[model samples]
Target: MLQSVPDDGLLPVDTAQFRTAMGRFASGITIVTARVDDIDHAMTASAFTSVSLTPPLVLVCVEKIARFHDAILRAGKWGVSVLGASAVDVSTHLARRGRPLLGQLDSYPHYRGRTGAALLSDALAWLECRTWATYDGGDHTIVVGEVVALDVARSSEPALLYHEGSYRTVQETTDER
Candidate 1:
């Protein structure tokens, strides 16, 4: 038997429910990358967004402690590769820390972007950018980038997604039976 507990600072929410709430807002997946020394540092992120099209600005929220965070800051540039449907495995590699950055490159393909960031091939879109600002936001840092260049590849593939702490694929064309 369980006893009643105080609300304290908790939001009266379970982790699963919280994740599900956020998951309802579907988003594209991306691997943010920068060069750290001779290595290409990268991490998977689903928090990428476009801030303004006029100034060609975009934002990616990264955990403050992520290894690639400092690298992106140091490089003053980053690459955002919007994952295509087939890149789910690639996303997993970047999402987890301690995995070599080049490990994903082995199976997938990539080339340096305009700012010398790694613009992975087969992505639906890629943005090579120089940072405009860094804002402190709780556990994550909001990095706004000044897009120096963008590459788009036409594909019928669906975008990958993060939902309920799991990777999911998008489905097109709904049918009622």
Candidate 2:
């Protein structure tokens, strides 16, 4: 799914500076999940994005060797659960690579989504997606999907964010557009 661009194609006038500046954009953390070998797999990701609205497309980047990468690819679907402030513990649980096997029934309080991926109940929003395509991006594989289901939260609680390699928070929302 690589869209080839000739060398003359320019990304930005200041790629390096923009990257450093974008690090200041603290977005919500999310857990992307899929099943592999009849076993559940999940990963903590901060690189989730809204791709489009017409078809409800979304994108999530998985590192080439991420434990959940191959599974998501194979499952041909995924669930994106946006962590709410109260769900930090669930986020921490899914993030542990050496974690003991947690049965689906008792795993982070979840319910099966439209695509059958576990959607955390505490998430501010959860979207079930059908795998659309996968493409290489250096050390990562970018996957795009069309949302098939949606769940939203009533409370707009503060969401956990990864910044400077650690979890942080925002106290106030900016009114500026």
Candidate 3:
């Protein structure tokens, strides 16, 4: 015999269903970077958002299992490089684990932000931030940072977009005419 429990909303949702539902929302791509122990670490993430305007706060979610999770926690400073449409290769390289940051940095043109985090050169935009707070986010941690510095490197370039498990670029519609 088997028993069924009431729907209390405490149980986790199916991963496939959750992913399919969430993928409908398109977002910009970013590589979150940090300098720890004089070394740079980075992760490709789409789970970033603006948290506040008055304090110029932004948030990025990182899985607790990611190697940079602890690095960010320890360093307390990070940079966000908004990838240009031409930055697909950069995003793919940084998204993988166990890669040396120095080698990648050498391969690509980059610069250090005010917070000492590495920012990819020619990015659509970049932001340097310091950790302001953290919150629980299930399997991930929500890192909120106060923006200290930022710049738009190339506003004319198309911004990279990610949706439905693939990379996309923004298109200009005729309605804008």
Best by TM-score: 3
lDDT ranking from best candidate downward: 3, 1, 2
Model 1: CA > 4 A from native: 1-17, 101-104, 174-177
Backbone clashes in each candidate structure, one number apiece? 0, 0, 0
Tell me each candidate's RMSD, in Å, in order. 5.5, 4.3, 3.9
Which 10-residue window of candidate 2 scores lowest in summed lDDT? 98-107
lDDT of 2 at 84: 71
**Tens-digit lDDT track of model 1 for 21-110:** 998887789989887676788888899999998999999998888877788889998899999878888898778777765655656688
Per-residue alpha-carbon lDDT of model 3 for 38-58, expressed as tens digits?
888888989999999989999
Q: Where in model 2 is the C-alpha error above 4 Å?
A: 1-23, 100-107, 173-177
In candidate 1, residue 20 scores what lDDT?
Answer: 80
TM-score of each: 0.83, 0.79, 0.90
Candidate 1, residue 153: lDDT: 88
Which candidate, 1 or 3, would have the higher lDDT against the true structure? 3
Maximum-lDDT candidate: 3
* Quality of model 3 by C-alpha lDDT: 0.90
Q: Is candidate 1 or candidate 2 better by TM-score?
A: 1
Which ten contiguous residues of candidate 1 have the minimum total lDDT?
Answer: 99-108
* Worst lDDT 10-window in candidate 3: 1-10
